[model samples]
Target: MLTLNQIKNNPEELIKKLSVRNKDFSQLIHDAIKTDNKRKEIQSSLDATLEQSNKIAKSIGQLFKEGKQAEAGKAKSEAAELKEKAKELTAKLNDAKAELQTILFEIPNIPHPSVPAGKTDADNAEIRAGGTIPKLSKKVPHWELADTYDLIDFELGNKITGAGFPVYKGKGAKLQRALIAFFLDEADKAGFTEIMPPLVINEASGFGTGQLPDKEGQMYQVTEDKLFLIPTAEVPVTNLYRDVILKEDDFPIKMTAYSSCFRREAGSYGKDVRGLNRLHQFDKVEIVQIQHPDKSYETLDEMVAYVESLVQKLELPYRIVRLCGGDLGFTSALTYDFEVYSAGQDKWLEVSSVSNFETFQANRLKLRFKKVGEKQTQPAHTLNGSALALPRIVAALLENNYTEEGIKIPEVLQKFTNFDLIN
Candidate 1:
């Protein structure tokens, strides 16, 4: 959520930057300013009414002491009327504030200046790529390999939980755990403190990370408890600092979490959602950071590079793309996507998205920081990235590393999996 000061101070510049997202928010901005003005007016009137009522009450005491009964009675009547008027004005102020908040909620974060202006993922600009795509003689998709090796039981999972929930067995489960451990270890090496957040979060937690109201439909809801199943560890991990005020010394706060994320993934179908490509429940290692707004972009670059290293270690062919405005997440000002080439699928599968939200989530979370000597506080920048999402990474690994003998595990993960190959 954008701050009122941002909207009030640079309406034109904000609108211009937001245009990169290809949506017009001019009217929404206008409505917010208008509603805020009305709210201020109501507040002023309420204050004046209370002040006048106080003066009348004070003078009424003097009047009664002076034996001016008629004048004191009239003053009491006037005070009562002012109190009623103040109540009406307070209600109007509350209504105006709600209206203003609604308008602000509808408006998305402004796109960063580097954000490309385009309509879809096709329009995204490729930044850099590493590793070579493997030319596998045997191109067995992960699902087939999972079946041939008896690693995953798709039908059993379907019978138990329905589609999009595959049961990993034997080495399949081991590989999943190995990847989670590997990613967490790498994140710890990168200076992120580990956290184990709740799998379900309350509405405030969802809103703190800009997941609620906009992406409510994509999240699994525990309606009875008014909680939501986290779509990513990013939600709970980032929300850890909600409504917190930090000192300047806390310039960069980095945290990591591995969680079983649950998403509705509503309306997904076709081959795209097959096997390990897409799932309702999946494991992921997430990295989150809270940093000073001034250095956030630099931090974003570091985060991107860190994610790139993870894929490189996995020995997967990967590319990084700068998301165009249309493809950008609602809360992200700038985002970089990491995709790995799956030999069997013969397509790049998105494995991670590193984004800098640039105080958008902070404003919503009321996450702020004060300088060493300054009294005023400012919103802190928030960022999070999938250090690695396991499903697609596993898909790409199995598909690209398949041999007649077995699927060769990356040497880096061999120590964790305790085996060099899954035959």
Candidate 2:
């Protein structure tokens, strides 16, 4: 949520800045300001009524002590009237405050100044490209490769469960485990503490990460238990510090976790739903950070470089793109998406996204920190990124490294996979 000062002091400037999102929040901003103003006005009136009531009660006591029964009765009556008015003002204040919060919740984080103006992925600016697209005269899609090798059993998975839940068998299962291990080891080497977070989260946890009520439809909810299946490890990992306060020395805190992400893929369509392109259940290694606001952007860049390293180690042809305003996540101030090229599909599949939420999630989480000699605390900045989502990375690996021999495992992952090729 934006600070109230931002809305009241510069709604016009805020509107102009967020125009890149292609939606106007001018009326919402104005309504929030108006609601806040009414809340303040009612609050002031209540304060005055309470103060006067206190003074009148004191006067009644004085009169009673002096045996002035008549005067005491009159002051008591006035105090009763003031108390009634205070009650009405108190109720008005609550309504106004709640109304303002409703409006604030509907607004998304303002984009950073560097964010480009655009409407969709086509508008995203490519930052840089790396690796080389292989020269493949013929390459089959990952689904075909899986079937030919008896690796993943989509039909079996359907018999047991449903679509989007492919069952891995033999080498396919081993490769998935190997990829998870590889990603975890890389994160561990990058100075992040490994965490094993729960797959199910409560409503509070969902809301803390801006998942509830915004992207609610995209999550699998365990309705009877009021728990939501985590869409990403980011939810549980980042909530580790929810409602927590840290000392100045804890400036940079990092955590990494591997989780089986569950998404409804609510309305995924057409070519987008092919094979591993979109899945209800997929594995991902996530990295999260809680940093001092001043150093968050630096941490964001560091995270970007770390993800870049993972893609390079895998030897996949990839590119980094800066997300345009419209494509940015709800809580992120700035985001960069990393796409790996899949030769079989002849498309760029997004395998990771690194973002700096810059206190947006922290504000909702109530995660705060105290400065060295300061008595007051301020919200810490939060950031998270997919170190790499396994499915698409696996897609690119199988597609790009395919040959008559078999799929070639990346040299870095050979030790984990226990073989050079999967035939």
Best by lDDT: 1
Report lDDT (CA) for all predictions.
Answer: 0.93, 0.91
lDDT per residue as tens, model 1, 1-423:
998899999888888888898888888988888888898899899899989989999999999999999999998999999999989998898999999988999999889999999999999999999999998887889999999988899999999999988999999999999999999999999999999999999999999988877789999999999999999999998888998999989979999999999999999999999999999999999999999999999999999999999999999999999999999999999999999999998999999999999989999999999999999999999999999999999999999999989999999999899988999
Clashing pairs in 1: none
What lDDT, from 0 to 1, does candidate 2 have?
Answer: 0.91
All candidates: TM-score: 0.96, 0.94
Q: Model 1 residue 383 lDDT?
A: 95
Task: Write down the TM-score for model 1.
Answer: 0.96
Displacement of residue 294 (Cα, Å) in model 1 is: 1.0
